[model samples]
Target: MNSKRSTEILVGLFVAAGIAALFVLAMKVSNLGDFTDDKGYEVVANFQNIGGLKPRSPVTMAGVRVGRVTGISLDPDTYDARVTINIYRQYDNIPVDTSASIFTAGLLGEQYISLSPGADDFYLEDGDVIDLTQPAVVLEQVIGQFLYSTAEGD
Candidate 1:
């Protein structure tokens, strides 16, 4: 009876460990594990359309992640979508003329902000707004345009 009880306890422990490992894996895969406060500088950019971009979306420069979107709001004055990004302090050398564009990881993957550096000598500072921005591309609009053109040509 004693040996049987010990075996049962070991099995329970093994199951519990497996469950914990799975939980950690889920959090990491979903980007929930890196929930620390943004220890970086904030910059704003306005877009005519944002599509499905949400907070916490990655901001990449040369295909390397440099920051994350911290907030997204609508500007009542200009009726534009205002996106706030928190850039890591280490990437402080981004030029003032750098351009930001919304892009997808894959054909139908999640959207993220991509930054292209410019030749300007000045660097962007905290709270500065990026004037050069490209809005997200909506796939539906492209398809609609294609269908309309094809029907017209027929």
Candidate 2:
């Protein structure tokens, strides 16, 4: 009876540990919209080249995530990317002079949008356009530039 009770306790402990492990895995891998509170309105920004920038990429200001890229499409006439950003409404106080820049994690890392807020009392309203936007930098283009520069130096 003593040996049986010990084995049961060990089994229970292992089961509890497994359950905890699964919970942690889900938290890490799931895009549960876990980090954001979308208390803001959506706005559009057009870019001539949105290279490798996909939906759900973070829209950050000064390295802090403020919003996300909600949608992407092409303009009917100019063929430019129409990127829709959903910012938290409380931060709608972001000035109209805010500039958007596409940045990478590293030379061969993921991409996310960066926002640079400018000093201006005027802020953006719903449906407003953020005209100052940058597009993602393509890796191939960077490699090409490196090769060309190396050849030139040689």
Candidate 3:
């Protein structure tokens, strides 16, 4: 009887470990497991369209993640998408003239912001606005244009 009880206890512990592992996996896949305590500096960029970009999307420079998107809103006057990015304080040397563009990871994957540094003596500071920005490319619009052009040619 004691051997049977020990086996049952071992099975219960195994099930609990599996549950904890699944919970951690879910957090990582959802980007909610970001354990960094870097409060970072905030910067703004304006775009005409921001496809599927959401808060917590990665901000990358040369394919390296430097920050995350903290907020996204619309400009009441210009009607453009205003994106707030919080760049890690360790990357405080980004130039003032750096340009930001939205890019997708794969054919139909998550969107992120990529920064291209420019030749400027000035470095971006908190509350600085990046004027040079490019909006995300909508695949539907591109396909529509391609189809129209092909039909016109025929």
Candidate 4:
């Protein structure tokens, strides 16, 4: 009876360990494990369209991630999408004239914001607005335009 009880206890422990491993995997896959509030300054950029860009999407600079999209809203007056990004404090030297463009990771991958720094010597400050912006390019629109042009040529 003693040996049987020890075996049962070991099985329970193994099951618990498996459950913990699964939980960690889920958090890592969904990007919820590294939650921290000190993400640094906030910057806003207005886009004509934001295709499938969600909150917590990465913000990259020259192909390197430097921040994440914190929020997205719409401007009722201008009818534009306002994207709020939180840049890391370590990358605070981004130029004021930097441009933000929405881009896809692959043909069907996730959408993210890409920042291109400008020649300006001044750096961006907290709550600054990025004036130069490019909206996301929808694949269907591009295909429609291509088909229209092809039919017109025929």
Candidate number that wins on lDDT, 3 or 4: 3
Clashes of 4: 0
Q: Tens digits of per-residue lDDT for model 1 on 3-75? A: 9999999999999999999988878676665555348799999998988899999999999999999999999
C-alpha lDDT (0 to 100) for residue 115 of candidate 2: 86
**Every candidate's lDDT:** 0.91, 0.84, 0.94, 0.93
Query: Candidate 3, overall lDDT?
Result: 0.94
lDDT of 4 by residue, 80-142 (tens): 999999998889899999999999999999999999999899999999999999999999999
TM-score of each: 0.76, 0.72, 0.78, 0.79
lDDT minimum window of 10 residues, candidate 3: 29-38
Residue 35 lDDT, candidate 1, scale 0-100: 53
Q: Superpose all Cα atoms of candidate 1 onto the true structure and report the RMSD in Å to 1 decimal.
A: 4.4
User: Which candidate number has the best lDDT?
Assistant: 3
* Ranking of all candidate structures by their lDDT, best first: 3, 4, 1, 2
lDDT of 1 at 7: 100
Q: Give the poorly placed runs of model 4, Cα more than 4 Å off.
A: 1-33
Model 1, residue 66: what's the lDDT?
Answer: 94
Q: Over 4 Å off in model 3, which ranges?
A: 1-36
Clashes (candidate 1): 0
* Better-scoring candidate (lDDT), 1 or 4: 4
Candidate 2 vs candidate 3: the TM-score winner is 3
